[model samples]
Target: MNKFRCLALISATALTLMACNPASDAKPAATIAAPLSATAATPAVTNNSSGKIVVYQAFTRLFGNSNTTNQRFGTAAENGVGKFNDINDAALVALKGMGVSHLWLTGVPHHGLVADYSAFGISADDPDVIKGRAGSPYAVKDYYSVNPDLAVDPAKRLDEFKALITRAHQHGIKVIIDIVPNHVARHYESLGKPTDVRDFGADDNTTLEYSKHNNFYYVPGQAFELPDIPAEFTPLGAEAHPLKDGKFAEMPAKWTGNGARAAKPDFNDWYETVKINYGVKPDGSYDFERLPADYANKNHAAHAAFWQGKELPDSWLKFRDITKFWLEMGVDGFRFDMAEMVPVEFWSFLNSSIKLQSPDALLLAEVYQPQLYRDYVQLGKMDYLYDKVGFYDSLKLLMQGKGTSSEVLAKHAEVADIDQHMLKFLENHDEQRIASPEFAGAAEKGKPAMVVSTLVGKAPTLLYFGQEVGEAGALDAGFGKPSRTSIFDYVGVPAHQGWLNGGKYDGGGLTAEQASLRAFYQQLLKFSSEASALKGEFVSLHPLNLTSPGYSEQQLSFARFDDKQQLLVVSNFAEKPVSFNLQLPADLIKTWQLSAAPVVFTDLFSQHQQSTNPAKQHRLTIELPALGSVVLQRQ
Candidate 1:
């Protein structure tokens, strides 16, 4: 057989072992040829001693974009992209007023884009390879650069982003950007990379398909081919490109980012990117030494010691340098994308270096494996992991009336060991908006869910930008469909723009209903941040009321308390009003040390007061409004 045919035959057979565990399928700007105006690397000084964090996630391209066209597959000029400069002091103050502690600006990295940026020494990205008119932010092109799309000057993009970071800090909000370690754009090139740092694949031996030191796995002797485009899905609204004719010239095709081994990956595959290898062979055996089992209970110092004087994979070292470079730019923390796909050993090395630099550096990750939660947090040194499969998925079901709040109690029990490290969120970029028809189809339905998510544990609370003003994710923004605010397209968010009010940041144009929803979010989040009870021990009233007539399965009531503050949090997920004798268990009464005298409890959320003697009567007849939540504080 010919060399190409022989390679293809062998590559196809190898995919069975390589493809079984692709990290995750769930699935930017500017800058100079050199580093921007910044001092030498210094460890960032963190001010999160209070131990409560409320992160506001904003799609950088769409956050300040006032363009209302929002047409399907619109170009950047047509859609009017938001710049780093667009997020003014007014915006920062407004976000801070909404009880934000951190502003996580998504899509800050320089990724493959459909727009031409060749004037800046950047190569033009083919739209055929891109997922949207604006490309997928996950398919990063350069590790050292920011996306020109988010910059007003493009050349000064890095400086503009730094200024925004400064502005956020001034407003008392820390900043977080994404770090995608699992993959990079198929046409990855780092023009802004340091002179000393070697480019990926610079010294790779491509004759072999797999190697311990190779940055990427190879389909030797085969040229890369583009996935066939479907009739319904057109690149850049059917716009033509010189490089869009189903051909890309990689001498030895690298394994696809999602682990597809074919020269031409399926259209659904992550074909725009190439996966990074971290010493895992084609047969799924580790080529690098594994950390000891006892390392799971060890701290970052111990983990760091394990890697000292040890030779590591090139990909691991390269990613470490990239992360350290960002940290030096005064960026406080990182949100690692698809962290589970990368090996935990690499995370231990990477996160230890991060913590060693800045001990309080927030190393949040997108890790879905419940079985591997403790491993990632305790051993991998991750500060927080996305609680999607547990709380988020359950909340969605509860909102749809298909599930009960009992799941909340069950999940807390299941993840109690890692409770503090499981970050709770409702509307992030990857999930559908609560107002979307695919979800609850109503914004108010999110109220109860938000209340519980924020106070469930000592975990951080997260909110998407438009989620406050009830921005329904129904926009037809190019490659990404409705139900999610598109991270891959240039589009204006309608409701968020209403709050932006043409960059006034005054919420001048918001409807009364929208205003109320945003107000509710502000109050709840503010309470969560300041409340001492949220950091206290959790006691789910679920088990005590399992047989009570007043406690429906849709209802959940719990108490979080310490000596200084005690809070009774109750939520009714039902559509109709429900009355129940809210039961407090004897263990809770003794744990909290209830007094025999009548204790007046006032609802912080609704300001409704109730006087009940808990010592004499352990249960109180309480009436909960339809689809509502109340936070009662002892008076």
Candidate 2:
């Protein structure tokens, strides 16, 4: 069973045994819990005009391969200390190497039901899953409880976790966890069964008539519809679609005159469980109350019931509360899951609340694609979402040899128009491997193209697991068990390509190809860290409209500037040699500099650079090889 759903069912069963039944005059679950409110004070926020900007590599499923000298993701063996501390220790070292300011350890709060358990080819009996399988931490079974396997002691788990946060803070590094308030799963019962719970909205009895629900959902003839009236609910089905258009008759019948649907998931599993009317159909399709046997089916009625209830459940309050609780535990921020699902009224309250509790706490949303940003940010006041703009599509184009390197630059600029976000990446637990058959060809240029993703524009870069190293994986990373891919199904690594393949073997260095790629990236990352790069605004390069078919025309140039510093970036997307002219903002010509071999550029990684003026021939013209780019600066 889905762990969180099971846990919730268990919680309700316990509550029913203790709280209500013979209702009316008995004291209720309490009013302070009434109306729904954030559990913590809002955090303080800065106007954030622009300070020393920093980069945070979302190292969620990507960590691990750490020892006392290194830090691994899910290993119970702390690097001579504890798990959190170990992650903090190893991460700091990596940050120093990459010069990153923050580290968003994706969904670190009590989470589990790791994807590899089902996806990475391992039978449950296959010890690898037990060892390597930490289900997606976002499938949270318990908000207050930390994952036992993640902690040395489940009893005092939060304390150790807090220590971990404390240590990371000492390093000047902040952390971010993932949050899920949408449809919770089956495990971790204290929250209650999401599927069976009552949804808010209409007075189904008086409105839609629970008189209908009264008959089959409960004590014979007890209808299971919601309290409010709306569109008739949709029952869960094997597939997610309507057979065709307007085929209302083909829809399934939810009631069929018996308590069948209620019996399926065990309605009594929840103390407040109630089924809703499905209207009528030959095969169910639109009922919010009914659902197919598949797990995590979105229950519109449950959401409706939640909206109707006079007092929000303790668990609901805990959703936002845990963020603060964890912040107190030393967690730096949150990466919310399915952010769009939760009603915005709730989040508006949450954003305001978090500010009072932990001012320094950062918030990241796991929003799908780019279109969803305006609703969340403009109205919801969210901080960041994953950048999926032209990323995957662009990578496909190049590997097929249909697009030039410059296309990557175009895509980045496209995504930035929506938001100066945390640039989402290709390595997360959700996406397929870029080298897999589903994406780029086997040559794996996807990795380098992905490297280009980190630097193409004005967004914060987010690197998911396995992207840095070339780990072989399925077209769908979240698919299923026992050895097809050959990675560790354990909690720490994917089955086919564990840490060794990820290139952090024995603390020395990575594989040769991995090393070369690493060098290239380190250079990009090194420059990205420069104070000017971190805090500057972008200006277009506007290359001349050259009609000649040379490589220089395939390039796109841009500049970043601040009151105190300015840097010009030229990225040549051409695959052949091309000559281009250097066009600088008029005033910059007097102080600008030129670069040569190994590219001695003034950036965060290096200091001491001088400028020189050349004759007209050299002044306006420059030469660049196929597939290359350069950065120049103003003295």
Candidate 3:
């Protein structure tokens, strides 16, 4: 019986073959691996075109314990191997000083299993049980490897380790890693032997469903559904369904006496507890018609192909062996994990594998679902994902002050003319905190209406790792209840501060309303990285004079043009001062311009220039203080 117990007793008699249907002519089961060839490979490039970014993606594990050692991107314990050049050259020198390109480190992989390490808060003088415990690096056992306890080498391997996309492309920044291909790891490591145990059911040799490639790819037409459990085989949790923790009694055949072979072959009722198999390839190209070729590593051909999550063939050998194994280590781009459920065949295999690392590789997909620009550009599949309906419709219409700065520059020029569909955001670690109880404190009196949801841009805005240093309470991977994520907070240490802005505010720039909302979000992301018609678009959405009082749900407006330039974004969600109406345009009175309360410009894509003053009035008349916003220019 040894040999991993004959492959766990033929994978536990494949759940008794669902009690009946064994003969559709039965036969196929004893296969092992081989036959794959057609390597071709190389494809995948995307840092998403056009621009506008403050893109942060510093996602620490959402609750469920998160303090991995050599903590991947939070190292500094004097660099015991803190990966990616020890915490990305001090957060890319405060995002190239506010004008950021991209960062997205998320969870760098190689964690075989700590699947839930008793939620890491462990007390009573600590005792790291559960084999180097930590949590949710998206539960992957090995999407290829690399977590040598996160580098400094736990015995090396993973192509020798470390490159972090060439130190974030020497400094142009742009790194993104997460890409977790669905699910795989219920104590994986099973392959073959244990002295054979076949029986797609010649009528119950202790039944078990069919073994080996069993039901082939399940798609005779599509919409599959299988759950028979005639009761008594129990099993529902202990990780069989894999979505992250489960129950229904952990379905081990419901309770056991084998009632109808535990409901016709396992899977407790099903609702995407996560086993996804539909695969069919009449020729569309995901062929697994019935696998049986490889006889046990006689050469490996991916042990006979199977696309598993539908199709995408080696997906550029699976996104170019993790960008040539993080470009040898300089690491630049990959943070995907469940990217719109994967498959544009994997972003046209990542646009031809990062086009020879041109402009420094970037693909970043953890798309936090918000109809992401019509689900990756009108249902075409994916180029990137995470726009939550244009960052919560520009943070819920500038905190319900309801559209106007010309409907917030016509909704950031209607999703900022392509070049990459929205990723812009305001608070992360899923819900709550953009100022707690979920914006119900009007995000600290709408800090300039959530700083115009980060300089109303065209993509790249994410931020979440205690967002600009001010992360308060409540929001441990929300959905409610148990919480514990860490990279140090409840005293383990390291919050550092840096980009949290607003100096003079005691102790530091984070809680004087998060340092005056990080001095208007570091001068509106250093003005969308030096504005070029706000990074594309030579002006549009020019509607002026919006009367106050009610002003369509409190005050929301717009104005972004390019005939020399005009920026007039105003967001005021009530609570006091407000007055609007800027009906100007008499040949620019020699190019009008006005600035007050901290204004600094120069945020680029190609090139831009702005310097303004003079406009106390000219049919113009604005005042937004009291939970406000205003950015007007023309020079």
Candidate 4:
């Protein structure tokens, strides 16, 4: 049975039993608790802070829009797009106050959108090839130009973006932008590239199907045909336009972005983009040199030196130059889209070049395969990889009450060796919101998962904008449905607008529950950013507490420690309040150098006090509310 049905059955039985015995002391089945208010007090933290990174991702088009007129398939003018200037000083200050060390400004580059800027010498994108009115951000139209829709003056868009970067730096936040290497828009053009630089496929031999110099894989003698459109759906919501007829002009079709080799891709395929060839031939043989087996242990600098004299593919060189252009523009780092799709050898070259220029540059990738995690991090030199398929998936099941804490512990063990390189997050632009009916169905369910995600390892934590305020992504902004905030259309986020508060960047318009949720996130993030033990060693306490009284697989416990500090973290994924004796194993106690004397344990969030003598008893009584968590520091 599904979790929802199981929960209903249990609750019904509990109510029946309670009716039979009026004097019973058993509490009712737990319901989600109302969150604390805005006036809730934050916990005090130590000054011995470690470099625990927290990244806040904001969709550039939706972050600052306060307009409530969310028309389905609406034009930018009707829906009102957010501008670069809208992310003002107050916004930066608010993000920094939440312990954000980096701000990933998504969808900043000029992409294929269904808008006309003929005055600026840019042609409009055809509706047949665009995903939505705003188009997909992954389909880059120009590598060197900023999106004109985001600027007050279309001609000065790049300058406006640079100014935003300056503002972010002033508030001690580094800037990161998207860098899509595996594909480009089908009609890609670089209007703002450097004088000496050549655009992608500019020097390609289109007649040849497989050449080291060719930019894209082509199907010879085949004319590109548009996919059959659904009768019920129309491009741009049936709005009359010149290019709405199911025809996109491409002769001798190239492969689709998802590597669809057909001349006509399916309607569900990534048909808007053409895949870039990175020296891997059509027959799956490498056209470029492969790395040696022993090179996995080598550092990035060594890999850089190894490629100094070797010849590389034209596509590789083009992407390398594109990255260099952004680095020169003071972009602190890049979030690579589909990094695993490209060869690891190319990453060794590209990432090493980036690190050589800016040693501290952050290189995060979207690689999901568990088998390739170490290759991308250790060999490809990526600083961080998304922990989606493993850690995040396990937590999602646990939040639904359909999975056990033992399963979570096992998943952690799979990547224990490289745990520090895996970044953790519960929501992003691609995932369903935790507050949505499709996921956990309540914002409070994310509290315990958030606590575990932030404190489980030494890797960075990612927070999507509006996640703190409990945005359910319920807007039906055409082409993008509910359960996920739209990235493909012009829309306003209601919950986020409450925090925006008419550009005040305060929670003035937020409800009491939302304000409380934001306060909880603030306290957790502040402690995660400043705690030294979070950056140190970790030991799971699940095994030791499995058979203890009042303990069940619904609760998870762990410990983190370093030379200067020690911490204990526990999260309850149950529907009812959980009371357990969380045991500290002898080995862990020895690592902390604890004596037989009583050691006081203070709850980091509530300041609730408790104590246990290690010699007399190796356990501490823990009580957590439904879907609640606690982080205790050893004193």
Candidate 2 residues lying further than 4 Å off, grouped into runs, are 1-62, 65-90, 112-134, 153-156, 191-316, 369-371, 390-400, 403-418, 422-426, 435-437, 441-452, 455-457, 474-509, 542-549, 552-554, 572-627
Residue 38 local lDDT, model 4: 20
What's the count of clashing pairs in each model shown? 7, 101, 82, 1
Point out where model 1 deviates above 4 Å.
Answer: 1-51, 614-618
Off by over 4 Å in 4: 1-49, 231-235
The best candidate in terms of lDDT:
4
In order, the Cα lDDT scores of the candidates are 0.79, 0.41, 0.39, 0.80
C-alpha-based local distance difference test score of model 3: 0.39
Error of model 1, residue 412, in angstroms = 1.9
Candidate 3 versus truth, CA RMSD in Å, comes to: 22.9
Once superposed on the true structure, which residue ranges of model 3 sit more than 4 Å away at CA? Answer: 1-105, 116-143, 146-175, 178-322, 326-360, 363-432, 437-449, 456-459, 463-532, 536-561, 571-575, 580-589, 592-619, 623-635
Clash pairs of candidate 4? 36-516
User: Which 10-residue window of candidate 2 scores lowest in summed lDDT?
Assistant: 1-10
How does model 1 fare in lDDT?
A: 0.79
Pick the winner on lDDT between candidates 3 and 4: 4
Model 1 Cα shift for residue 559 (angstroms): 0.4
The candidate, 3 or 4, that scores higher on TM-score is 4
Candidate 1, pairs of clashing residues: 28-147, 29-146, 29-147, 29-148, 30-146, 30-147, 30-148
Candidate 4 lDDT over residue span 1-635, tens digit each: 00110011122111111111111111112111111112111111112247488889999999988888998878888997888899999999999898988899999989999988879998778878887788888889999898898998999999999999999999988899999997899889889998988888888777877689889988888889987756433437656888878899887898877666788977655678888888877656677777764666777788899888887998888888988988888898999987766777889899989988988788889875666677777667788899877788898999988888888878888887777778899998878899999988998999999999999988889999999999998987766668889888899999889999988899998999999999999999978888888878999999989888877888899998888888899998887998877888889878777777888988998999888856556578899898889899877
Residue 38 lDDT in model 2? 18
Tell me the lDDT of model 4 at 125: 83
